[model samples]
Target chain A: MTATATNKQVILKDYVSGFPKESDFDFTTTTVELKVPEGSNSVLVKNLYLSCDPYMRTRMGKPKPSTALAQAYALGQPIYGYGVSRVIESGHPDYKKGDLLWGIVGWEEYSVITPTPDVHFKIQHTHVPLSYYTGLLGMPGMTAYAGFYEICSPKEGETVYVSAASGAVGQLVGQFAKMMGCYVVGSAGSKEKVDLLKTKFGFDDAFNYKEEPDLSAALKRCFPKGVDIYFENVGGKMLDAVLLNMNVHGRIAVCGMISQYNLENQEGVHNLSNIIYKRIRIQGFAVFDFYDKYSKFLEFVLPQIKEGKIKYVEDVADGLEKGPEALVGLFHGKNVGKQVVVIARE
Target chain B: MTATATNKQVILKDYVSGFPKESDFDFTTTTVELKVPEGSNSVLVKNLYLSCDPYMRTRMGKPKPSTALAQAYALGQPIYGYGVSRVIESGHPDYKKGDLLWGIVGWEEYSVITPTPDVHFKIQHTHVPLSYYTGLLGMPGMTAYAGFYEICSPKEGETVYVSAASGAVGQLVGQFAKMMGCYVVGSAGSKEKVDLLKTKFGFDDAFNYKEEPDLSAALKRCFPKGVDIYFENVGGKMLDAVLLNMNVHGRIAVCGMISQYNLENQEGVHNLSNIIYKRIRIQGFAVFDFYDKYSKFLEFVLPQIKEGKIKYVEDVADGLEKGPEALVGLFHGKNVGKQVVVIARE
Candidate 1:
């Protein structure tokens, strides 16, 4: 074991409301061991590529009575998120030095993970770009796969609608549905994303939801027959409008509700009555619940990636210092595809 | 063949806004045929017990662009709901004179149904009271059975919670959970209903939601370890509170949101974030979607009913004149149990 040393970390300054600022996280140096401690069941990881997910925005807020997924980030503590990392040292038997893994790691590069590791997986298939593990082959990829297949239960020739069409999960979901022989439509905030969804991701149709004044009418125009399945990534108004245009027995897979994450006051869904009237099924699911199927997902997705049957697009920020901006960009729809921050290439 | 004659019917006077009034419906003497006309594949039936469900309140309003299940009732036309009826005559090959069926029927003494006769099912189980067709062995029964068994996926020794506990669906859900060896808890509006849940329906615990100042605390008291399955019949504050007390991987079957039905603005759910952290699955479902399982449900529930392993309660309001009030009573938690209006006994 190497000698213990101090490390620098980025700690959450305070809980945020609405949109978060860079000042919300403070970069500070603190003493820490570079090596794993003796007899400890922990690993020392150096985060390479940190994922900027929209859901992390909710974690920046104060601990509420019912924040979904996990507890709020503690004040003055290192804020953590999904990151692809190299294990510098390991005291646990399952992992060894130089082994690669992707899991929850602190924002600042180094982390000491103890007792409960959040959805950690060993990187077995290294043929793809390592950064691909940050988005396409990691949490976001699993989210799109499980949420669409397991939750939405898409059928061939069905009309599928996806919100946040160019985001990590949304883009993949639309593509997967299209591959399943479904008529897929996607909604984005900008014309750029709309084009990417239609041309790049191969969505049957794509629209800029921000440009449309009447979302329900826009949906009706896109899906004259009504949407058979909706991949709900952005909640609030989009959800309300989608409820109106959902066909009888439509299925909605609630992956994440980006629109409501940073709001001081969450938007109310007005057309919930459609859930009963149309006999629609709206289900909220987390990727972790489908971890048992991860091996199977990898078996399926990896071949597609290798064969060029599946294409992934990423908006990679250069450094860890720009991580907050990359993350906040998700809310404003600035990131065109999967928002990721590459702290280091090697 | 019997001569065709117009029959008297009950019509919605106008669209209702908040709590419905007695004047919302008018029983007008209109003539209807006792027999189906030639060249039309339709059925003419004499309505027996008309079900006064809380969902009917939504139909009293003007046709919104997105009402899910049943279409909005046309102004000056008779309101319709689930009912048990005797097929007096039929032009459809599937039905003939004197066939007993239960399905969508006018809130009057008779109705003419056409085009789709698949929604209607012949009454195979007749040992129980025919009024059971209005609830158990009908839509509400299938709702309780499917919503609990199919959606919630209860396991033995799991903690289950049912809102609107003494109502048509909730009562049966609680008893079904108990039969499955689950620790069932229920919430109702009044002490009588609460007592009925515990003493009559075999719920492990029951509370009057109206009396509880803190719904979350009440849930904590009932489920010290947290609820594993929640049958959500009443939405709004109850849903918000239940979110806080849900165990990891908990399942919530959204059967109905009766609490938010009449409100001009739907209540915002403040605790939805719990859904992500606890890995909870909140799914909205309708009984109609589970129609394929109707026979299976009857096979399961009928024997339980015969053995007195399951008990059902009904609040029967006599005459079509009291129907509007009885239907509206559901929203305010005024009805003691399953609110039903007996149009005729024989």
Candidate 2:
């Protein structure tokens, strides 16, 4: 129990501005004793999988008062986000050694979690892959569920459009919309992702936005009736284009604005005028708000996953050193599905 | 029954592009037959007052697919809008001669109207001034009512920010927030309008946005706690500023974007990412959509108007010929309050 091991971590070098580069982070190693600080309510866990998300880009920036929506990720520290882990030791009564958990954890080989409110949740079901906790059974999953079903107020047979459709959240949203008998269309950045959305996720249609010189024309070609519910993952020009193509009384659930995250100046949405006549509603929601229904969500989504009614895709990169590339690949649409970095099998 | 008379009318010369001007319209005289087309359901009325609104600028634009929210006004024809009138002829079973009405009518000394859905609501109460029908009892009133009470979902003690705060709709919105026990603050274009907001309209605080170098700083001064509900009328930079100051779970009821209407390039809003952690909702609604709730709205607002709980200000201009000047003045914030043109006092 007193033996020490090398703890490898990916640390942010400084707060970023403009497009994030791999050099923004440094891979460093430190020594750790296999023991929890005595009398502290912290749980020591061996990290299994690390999730890569677009929202992490926002945290990498220097904090602004407006960025208070989510607390800014502190610089010169190991980046923290959703991760799957195995508890090796515990000072908290609710968690014991050998228990599994998923929630916010540092991007490292091992993490000592001082549990904070809404920070972590005990893992009950292990029949599913542990890495699922980093994705489909994780924040992105809850985001798709709440953003699509609740914020979108989707009705069966309505047309649903998801931008960044092959990313972690978009893939699930399109699948959920299809499950509800919706006419689902997704726009991805690359041909492979677009094809994956149509063939694997069963979207009614999919388009590569990069290929479509005019997004409004591309949307018109995809959904002639216009989008009823838009799971808005990418903002900027896509949003302006979607505004022009929405139907009367449409709802846009702004889950993320991936496109605008890296730029110093976010692209302005010009066609917001369409929101008035179309009686449109554009609302931004974070998954944390809907965490109270996590159990309800698990009960609803688990059976579908087990029954093969839902399929999840993960772009897995092995080892902690690969963290920077996996995280940076997200901003470029370099990965095809849920981006995850595997630290260990245990 | 067939006698003809010279009727003074304000006609649009052509579609407008940029800020509207007085030259965009022409003052002319035309002949009215003083009789409805034989056996038709048309009603001939002598227009008493013509309402000038910012939305009319959108109507003056060359028709685009998005302008389809409200039908565009035809060029080479007398412009039409909400007006107070005395019925001189009627072929519909709903009314007969000498009846008073407030609804859509041509901006002329006399107009012949064919009743259309949502275009007209029969005036059941006239104890209030007939000119009140053009504003306080008409679209702007309903607009403020539905946009605040219905869309805002306002709660007592919540903070509300109303832009264009001394205009026809903004004035009423501030009053309604006050009556609801909300802390209300309004921003107007001029010092005079700002004074009116605090003193006459019962706003807790007011600001002359034009005088403030930074709108965000002005808003922070007026609402240190952050805005709970935003009544968005003047969009562009003001909307961008408001977004930066909205509280968590705040709602923005987008009424109109008057500042963007006459511009060839609409200004872009940058701080929309605030919607995420703040969990803010921005919804666009039109009074026409809530017409089914008209009876309910009148039941709620009529007593307040009669008891002097609500005070309305009108910037009355003389004659039908003043229509162009009055209408153009709105783009420049020329009118102090509700802009109305007196076609004929009767």
Q: Evaluated with DockQ, which candidate comes out highest? A: 2
Off by over 4 Å in 1: A1-6, A30-34, A92-94, A114-118, B1-7, B30-46, B86-100, B110-118, B124-126
Interface RMSD of each: 2.5, 1.2
The ten-residue window of minimal lDDT in model 1 chain B covers B268-277
| Candidate 2, residue B103: how far the Cα is off, in Å | 1.0
Please give, for residues B1-346, the per-residue lDDT of candidate 1 as tens digits: 5676656678989888877777877878777767678888999988778887887877777777666565688999888888888888889888888888888888888898862543688887778888898898888999898899898989999999999889999999999898899999999988889899989999999998888999999999999999999998888888888988998889988888888777777777766656566767777777777889988888888888899888899999887777777887777888887788887777
At residue B177, candidate 1 shows an lDDT of 92
Residue-level lDDT tens digits of model 1 in A1-346 = 5465556577889899888887787877776678877899999988899998987887888887555465689899888888999988999888988999998889877788752444788898888999988788999999999999998888899999999989999989988998999999999988888899888899989999988999999999999999999998888888889988999888888888888888887776667667667767767788877878888989999999989888789999988878877877778889989999988888
At residue B268, give the lDDT of candidate 2. Answer: 80
Q: Which stretches of candidate 2 lie over 4 Å from their true place?
A: A1-3
Where does candidate 2 chain B have its weakest 10-residue lDDT segment? Answer: B63-72
For the predicted complex of model 2, DockQ is: 0.74
True contacts kept of each: 0.57, 0.73
Count the clashes in each prediction. Answer: 18, 0
TM-score of chain A of each: 0.97, 0.98
If chain B of candidate 1 is superposed on the true chain B, what is its TM-score? 0.96
TM (chain A), candidate 1: 0.97
